[model samples]
Target: MFALYSGSLAEPGDPNPYAGGESLVLPKLWFAGYRRMLRVRIETGPAMQRYRAASRLN
Candidate 1:
């Protein structure tokens, strides 16, 4: 099992509660022979930034 947390702050002065805070839970893979070929990358920085911008527009 894998647990991950990602958060971002829009502004230093402005404290937005809904800025960007997400929790992701990933289950472990029990493959018999595929660990070496499998790869995973988690990059949520850009997505979080976009979300903050959209919120401001609305």
Candidate 2:
């Protein structure tokens, strides 16, 4: 996972040099695959919950 930060200050006198001025460069295919993984997780979340509940009952 990657984190994006903007306008972040490191100290009272120090500030991020790239903050608000730079953008992250990532491959389009990588971003697309990440999004697909997220979609699968979201779609299966409810089913996983149901499976867990049934296992507890059994």
Candidate 3:
């Protein structure tokens, strides 16, 4: 669990990383979220369509 957050933990109650790390969050989460976002965008961003198509076939 600790390793999973490698760098996404929002400290105590904040969702934002430390001050110097603010910029890194977007790119980091981008790559993290981009995996699914990419699969979705491959068919069209917010790719639930692709996911749905696959699910229907299954």
Candidate 1 per-residue lDDT, tens place, 1-58, comes to: 2111111212223333332445222211222112322222113366767887899999
Candidate 2, 37: how far from true, in Å? 0.2
Error of 2 at 6 (Å): 26
RMSD vs true structure, all candidates: 16.3, 10.7, 8.3
TM-score of each: 0.25, 0.35, 0.25
**Order the candidates by TM-score, highest first — what do you get?**
2, 1, 3
Give per-residue CA lDDT, model 2, range 10-34, as digits (tens).
Answer: 2223333444544544333334445
Task: Give the 10-residue window scoring lowest on summed lDDT in candidate 1.
Answer: 1-10
Q: Using alpha carbons, what is the TM-score of model 1?
A: 0.25
The 10 consecutive residues of candidate 2 with the worst lDDT sum are: 3-12
lDDT of each: 0.32, 0.47, 0.46
Clashing pairs in 2: none
Better by TM-score, candidate 2 or 1:
2
